[model samples]
Target: MEVDHLFEIGDKIVYPMHGAGVIKAIEEKEIQGKTQQYFIMVFPVRKLQLMLPIAKMDDSGMRLVLNMTAIEKVMDMFRQGEIDRSLTYKQRYKINTDKMKTGKTQDGAEVIRDLMLVKKEKALNSNEKMMLREAMQFLISELELSNSMTEMQAADLLNDRLNVEKDAG
Candidate 1:
């Protein structure tokens, strides 16, 4: 049975942790003798495919791509922020991980912003380094779809104004 859904084919959306992708199909497959509808999405840049069960979509932390205006606000967030050095690294990582799981562009930008600030002071541990890398890729992926930017263009945008010094000399 074909039914209309909130998202349709060709719609672009962000799947938390996997980045942005275009919905290619809504398919029903029989698994464990049960048939269920799934959204099949393709991440162009990464050449990755993901299947999201319709019943579980809301719980998956997936979201539609941000519009240009909201994306601009996210960029602003990346440009403004101070790290809380008081917390231990584990606590910080837990908070950042929670932010990433929100599937909100603003939270991802905040994670990136806080980590970049930490980087300016000292090196990030292996886990922090990996978190930073994943967050960066996710940001760039969403930015590309939001503004119709090439991956390179999106990356360049992220780098711009990122070298700000908190204290003016």
Candidate 2:
């Protein structure tokens, strides 16, 4: 149960199933008679605050946003357009969900690319649509932070790079 202490206040981090957010504070709270450190994170997009136990940082899939060089690589992933659309929707959903849970920039891009391909051929069900939105948001938020781009700029950049629809709503 070793937690990697890599984050500090003001550091931008990404949480799996969540999005990019800033660490607002660090505090210790006693729970069940044991005191532990936590990172207080504020997600502006979601308008949510989270107190993540420091001891569970790695286990929780929290990670620093990619650096600029890494982000460049992620952008390249979008250009390849190598989506595997052969799987059934259920199978694709499961695979995409697993990728999203990894909270990696490239994985998120892959999900967006795959789903956008699916959407172009046919409309997605509500669940798939939601998943596409979330994954795109996750990717965009990280790009915004890591690249110091505005949200609109990031969205436009991604749209141009991936050649996908703009309806990430």
Best by TM-score: 1
lDDT of 1 by residue, 51-160 (tens): 88898987898788988788877677655667887999999999999998887888888888898889889999999999998888888898898889999998887776
lDDT of 2 by residue, 1-169 (tens): 3445888899999998888889999998888999998899997667789999887887998988888788777766654565565688899999999999998888888888788777878899999999999998887788788888888887777777665433332
List runs of model 1 lying over 4 Å from the truth. 2-4, 164-169
Cα-based lDDT at residue 10, candidate 2? 94
TM-score of 1: 0.92
Once fitted onto the true fold, the runs of candidate 2 whose alpha carbons sit more than 4 angstroms away are: 1-4, 82-85, 164-169
Clashing pairs in 1: none
